[model samples]
Target: MFKFGNIYIIAAVAVIGGALFGFDISSMSAIISTQAYLCQFNQGGLDSDGKCVGPTPDVQGGVVAAMPGGSWLGALVSGFASDRFGRKTSIQIGAVIWVIGSVIVCASVNIPMLAVGRIINGFSVGICSAQVPVYITEIAPPTKRGRLVGFQQWAITWGILIMFFICYGCSYIDGTAAFRVPWGVQAVPAILLFCGLCVLPESPRWLAKKDRWEEAREVLALVHSHGNADSAWVRREMEEIREMVEFERQNADVTYFELFKPKMINRTMIGVFTQIWSQLTGMNVMMYYITYVFTMAGLASDDGTGVLLPSGIQFVINVVMTVPALLWMDRWGRRPTLLIGAFFMCLWLCVNAGLFATYGKPATGNHNAAVSMSITGAPAKAVIASTYLFVASFAPTWGPVSWAYPPELYPLRVRGKAVALATSSNWAFNFALAYFVPPAFANIQWRTYVIFAVFCAAMFIHVFFMFPETANKPLEEVEQIFDDTKPGAIKYIGTPAWKTRNTRAAVLKQERDQLASDEKIDAAAHKESVNA
Candidate 1:
């Protein structure tokens, strides 16, 4: 069978899993405001102004939240599936599951049925989100790992952009077809992902865990050395992997409980909180309900294009800004990227909140009361621009780093389980916010942005003091850094090496020189033996 050996090809195909997540996101976001969707699922139906009035916020929230609720469970189960079935097979399973879910969603006749279908789709997303990063991280060279794993986030944004446009185009169609067409179309990516997995190699680290040494070496060479199994880089990587795998095998009985133990708790906290913080950045509120946000900002109207076109611009900005992270994440490193991202997101959110609070007024009859307050004129434009700024900050920073950082934190023994746990934290928070935000908009009004701003501020502080820089370090070395560094309960106590590490160029040069010294030593020893 023809197998894909190019790391770029593997990343592109595997990140279709991430695209599936993106598809699900825009699948609803694009259509939620359309008349057909409002007519089909909303009980109160369209108001005098043709906006969805609905039977309370929970119904809409539940419909949107179902996928993430299912995703939370799917992420938990993914660890077992990836560990037992291999990373390639786990993603294939998710793809198959997504097709089934999309079909149910497309065929749904009512809200209950729609929710069930979305839940199923969420399950698939949960699995793919947890494992795609794991697979990519395992195959990528240390120097390029950030860029490759970053493809997952990039794929997600592309999925969002593509699906949003697809649904946006379909929104012009009459009746329920507006939603059904796009919902059904979501199955296409999953089908492509399932077929793509046929030619993709399993994670080499997974192969090593199964005691398939030769297969592991072949995969490593395929990815890193253009299929030269005997290449020095390949040999060095395989040896390191073998050592770690064997070391982990000694305690192979490790389970979820082990993640909570003193030795592992710090990493577990970092991984879990990283995911939670990403969701709390309030970006999802923008993605899931941008139309509602724009309505509140007084930029939207009955025609929907006012909201759709601007929201489309936001999605475009999200996709375009992410390219920088893929290019420079390894060089710029994780710590600074996160800190800067968080601070700016917080600033933008604050700006958005102040604009809304200062210039907004109570929403009047037939003018989308769900948004509660409306801001017009200059303040409203500032609100919209601040949202774009917030997304730009998130796209290159927390967006990719959250996914890339967690998988690098664990040892081979429990990597799958640990990553699953971290991703589950993401879904759990996602489910809550998806359900909570609509009602929050109606009740708390501008204060919603205030809450997200606070989350961004707290996360900035946390990253500054807690997150270790993992850029350019081998996965094995990342574990050692965590062990070697001490965590303190207060500020200015036990600052981490991430604050002091040399530049990426210096680090790579040091490793290359060490490898040369080792090779020369081995050559001299062999020559002495031959002479004797």
Candidate 2:
């Protein structure tokens, strides 16, 4: 067995990518309410209320919605970058973009400049989220894979928690500095990542695809094998990748549109559904709008540019709730954990919605009559509990698995493109929710959460039907599963669905049989020595 620390170090590399992903999410959330950051050079000066003077409701929504919309473009580009350049490079590139984007927001004297920075950061976060888990899952050993990569989800929740706290601490400062402090805080980790990523070895499997066998072998040995490994083993892996890609290439001619081919239809379905399943769970909406939820619940009040709760304390509490899941997931398996989490998420959303529906009332201080008159006292406490439960339920399941599964489900040839489409869909849907949510909050209030509860209920059904157990299978084996559906059909791939499916099962069984043989041999050798 390998030492635990080395595995952790390897895991940390991937987690840092996740960290950047989380950092942007939290940072953007922190930045959104800061009117100073939203000030416009073109719009002249501050209003009588001392907020940015420019833009009515619709125009302001556009400005607020800009970054989430830009994420669609980021996810689209990540597909090509991860599939073409390499996963590690995509993450590194994202780190650089994140730093640039963070600086733009923090330094901005007007809303337009902050908008540009937000878009840049949004792009980096989208790409970082898609690429990090794909890289980590590919590298981890089967036995510990779940535990290690689950860190990504755990990291994200903790990141959100920290950002909330930062927003809280920064809230204590008055005026422009209130917003700038939290925006600038993001630069620290991102700068660290840009420096740190340069030291990491490229993902070996990605290198193998480029025909760089030696580099691939060296990387594999560093991260995977226990100290030393046979070169033939490395060659064997390359051969496997070559066969899989060549098989996919010969069938589809390696074009991006070939993802829609008859054989790949299920693979396509899995990608789309899993992504849909992720966002539909209501996590993003909650993440996007929880501060308002908190405000309505009596958690905090507006302090100049942002809300005033102790964000750091809240983040610490959130991390404590989330980090435990990283340990339990492998013990429980992906499906059970997801089912459990979904039930709780549905429950949380219902309670949260119900509380708002029943008892929500307006506050005395805030500007908008709608918000000012919103729920106070016990109703606020319920909202706080609702936010906690929402974060807790998602921490172990939907959050990480959605990020983890896409690359595993698709083989190398189509993995990049399929992931691109899935992430793009995620960002597109996110843009819709983020765009509409604040308005929904401003106008519909409790009804907004009622809608989220409905979406979460639907996701529960989809995840139960479709998510695969991809915990252990290599890409070679995963491709063979798709190839099996057609026999000679893997060549032409127009065979009956029944026939192609049987092929997938047979190939997987063959791989399992080989693993069984090795295990049997080891057992026999141990028994023989004991008898002697």
Candidate 3:
């Protein structure tokens, strides 16, 4: 009897690290716009109109960009850590880092302190972001891998949403408590993650790679087969894992430089660029500086609570829409969903650029009542709606797919290194955008959306030509798609070998039967040789 319950528990507990990732996103986004944070860190002071004036574009960009700078370092280090320490231990280390970072952020009294804390937080996020999907993919059944790995993205969105509300509630406070309360609360999830990881089993594939065959067999049996070590399903799966690991050990030494080898470069590029494209989608700009977007869209610049409404809406939409995407991902396939999402995101961004160009006003240095009330009508609402539409388009597609895709792209030998490289690309671009958006908004205004719109269009063409479908394919089989050199391979990029559940079941049955036959033949040959 197969038991899914243990796998679900493991995934659920493991992905709490994602909540910390989310909390940092909304927590900083919320604070940067608050009067208390502005007053403390940005040299903000009361103007003639008695309203707070926040940090200049460069300062704000540096503060926001600092996290990903640390994240880039963290992502690079995580590959080595996960490979050496194991996945569960790597995640636990990240959780400890997160709690410490959160505490630092919550206690900060100045800009440097806050930046340091955020960088620490970013480092932890980088580790978790790289490891969580790989761990989940390694542990999950092939049929449920996409959905299970998807839980990381789901938790991230939930963390962002929950923190948005927490910050909203804090905005009512009079002083630094507005930011401190929310920052401190993030430690809760980090603590949960640290505690939970204490009991979770290490990834069986990782254990097998380390030549711990007995432990890997026991873990596979525990997770996949209700503790039945003799179950055919467990036996066949372990045999497949052992064969792959042995072949890798004999054929290649896992190294970062190996990822650039000719045979591996295509998969490496796919992983790296997929992550780069994900950051360029302008989603984080919306996430990190939503208040600024609302202000430009004609919402009252002074109305902190009102600005939060869109963040709230974005959170709700992200949570709601991601479910359908998860359900449809394995069924409809990865390539089509990504292609469709890029197209729609391009459409919405174009609309946003047009609306902002038509009705946009420059952001004043200080919030003014008159400026706030200047343009309140259809144009503002259109910009707001278009922003929501863009989020709606992304939540189901790029948001989740970014986290899910890279882990499945590489073989076990280089999976950690490949994912780290890809994830580092994500953070590198993430730093670029986080640094660019504030100044871009200040200078070009509406043209900012135009830049993202163009990127979205380019991404569609890239996905169509380069990305192959990995949905519903077993880890070993996914490599074959890239290895294929047939003339019409591009045309079949989005097609899966086993298209339905029944077909997949039939294929697994055949493999199991073949394995049993091979075992019998080997046993007979060994017996005859010994007798002779």
Candidate 1 at 186: error in angstroms?
A: 0.9
Give me the displacement of residue 469 in model 2, in angstroms: 2.9
lDDT of 3 by residue, 374-452 (tens): 2348988887888889989998898888888888888998898789889999999999999888878766777888999
Q: Select the stronger candidate by TM-score from 1 and 3.
A: 1
- Per-residue lDDT, model 3, residue 348, is 96
For lDDT, candidate 1 versus 3, the one ahead is 1
Better of 2 and 3 by lDDT: 3
lDDT values of the candidates? 0.87, 0.65, 0.81
TM-score of each: 0.94, 0.82, 0.90
Task: Give the top-scoring candidate (TM-score).
Answer: 1
| Model 3 residue 262 distance off true place after TM-score fit, in angstroms | 0.2
- Give me the runs in candidate 3 sitting further than 4 Å from their true place: 1-5, 301-303, 363-375, 484-532
Alpha carbon RMSD to native, model 2: 5.9
Cα deviation of 327 in candidate 1 (Å)? 0.3
Candidate order by lDDT, decreasing, is 1, 3, 2
